[model samples]
Target: MTDAPGSEGPEPSEPPTSRREGGGLRRAHSAADASASTTTGARSARAEFETHVAHARAEFEEANERIKQRTGRDLILAIVIGVAIGVVVVASLIFFKWIFLLFAIAATSLGVFEFVRALRASGRRVDLIPQLLGGVVLMLSGYFVDLWLHWVLTMVVVVVLIVWRLLGQMFSRDGRTYGAVLSDVLITGLVVLYVPFLGSLAMILLSQDGGEWWALAFIIITVAADTGAYVTGLTIGRHPMAPRISPKKTWEGFGGAFVAALIAGVLLALYMLGLPWWTGLIIGAVILGTATIGDLGESMVKRDLGIKDMSSWLPGHGGVLDRLDSILPSATAALALFYLLSPLAVS
Candidate 1:
């Protein structure tokens, strides 16, 4: 080939670009370098992305582990408290006929206080006087509810609440009205009376019946139901029953509770309480239904207050009220059923 431009004969082998114009070869070299740099940058970005993902995964795992640890601790605490209180109550029943009734009244009072506090926390005003009056009336009438006082006290509650609301509006502050006061009073009365007041019936049944096997049976079945639901919910719950109110409650857990409650009933009745299978089954059904109702009721309360968990008073259980809320209704219903059907009713 002829010498390229000024180059001598047998021109040096230039790259394809410079072969035509040396400038072309220079541009080609630069393009290759730029492309290699871009590729290297892409690799570096990918590497950084992987590192970030690993860090996020580690944090997530750590959080889950901490949650699990807290859960285990709470469960242990619940068992201890339940066992201790149950032991004390059982021991007292031997020496006192109505000690648990006093306990029930005290619990009702405390529960009422807790409820009102929740209301106030949620930007609602609840005059303590009327609520306390209603609560006291409800408590006193607890004994006579099976007879004549229950309906009367309920009527009184309704009336007092209505009057309280009228008085409250008349005494409005800075154009603010206590319009919800009436509803609050009425609902609180019903909850305190029906839940804790009537719950005293369980105590009456056990202490007065000359046999506490039934009470023990109730404790066992309900405890089993609670345990089963909790355990199964933690592991296998997929479909939520009430996602907004109780995210943890699920159909799968409920089914597990039903089965566990039935098993608990069978064990308690046949082996411990020495009752017939039919009776055991009946008790199990009652426990299952009441357990669900109690849970739903408490869930409703917490939801109304725009809060999660009644309080963190009881490490694992949320609050004293939360833990006792379900049991109150369940205990009351069990006793009422006993008074109507059990051998204790023969008297």
Candidate 2:
């Protein structure tokens, strides 16, 4: 392999710098391709995740809508509010008994306020101040004083309400007829008897020894009954219990309520109150009757007033009265049960 002078051997073996530069360019191109592939894969993954999330959200919304249609209310909101109220009540009952008295007074006042507002909305004259004052006094008397004093104060409040209304009408130039005044007086009386009076019974129960537990027991059972009825009715309600009063109520619901109340009563009496198991049945039956009647009575009042609810103060609960309807009457029943069953409880 002898080469002549000035011969270009193997094309002078490509320059080292040029070869390095060419290799660098090819490597850069390879890197760019890999980056593009990675970006595409990331986009595809993100798109898939977004689609799954959207589908899940749609399913949740659909379920919520179905519940609303079946219950005529937002079930989730109702449950949340209901749980919050339960917590407050339980805390007040457990931590300090006096706190419950205050809670009751406040609740009754609000309920009376709602009722008065509803009555006024229906073109009826109502005295809100006296009702609130009377309710507070009733609860205080029941808690601090004796049952007799509570009754006496209740009568005093009634008379004051009547006189207040009569004097207001007498002085006013509205020309409201005597019959109208009478109707107003009657309604005022009803407001007292329905809310404060029954609610005071709970105060009386709390005043007694071990009465707090009884109060809690009855309340739990009442709530259980309400929950059972709501679930059963929403699930398989057919025959109307009171089509005229409450079309949503059904016999099936009532049956469910009965079973739930009985179970709750039995458990509470046996474990918490330490009363005979049979007493639980009695408690359940009595509370069920009273609660159902109270619910129906409130519904009848709403029907007469031509209002869907007393007020929309509580979002999912309608009004304070709406929530208290069952509890108010059940308070009286619970107090009575306490007296009758106290003898059987373990000392």
Per-candidate TM vs. native? 0.68, 0.85
lDDT of 1 at 101: 54
- Who wins the TM-score comparison? 2
2, model 2: CA deviation in Å? 37
Give lDDT tens digits, candidate 1, residues 113-181.
777788778866666667666766665565534535566666677577656756775677646634565
Per-candidate local distance difference test:
0.69, 0.89
Please give the RMSD of candidate 1 to the true structure. Answer: 15.8
Model 2: residues with Cα > 4 Å off, grouped in runs = 1-57
List, residue by residue over 1-347, the lDDT tens digit for candidate 2. Answer: 78789885565545447877889878988999999999999999999999999999999879878978876677678889999989988998988998888888888999999999999999889889988888888888888897777888888988998899888888887888878888998998999899998999998999998889988988898899999999898889999999999998999999999999999988988999998999999999899889999999999999999998888878767898998999999998999888888799876
Clash totals, every prediction: 2, 0
Number of the predicted model whose lDDT against the real structure is largest: 2
lDDT of 2 at 166: 84
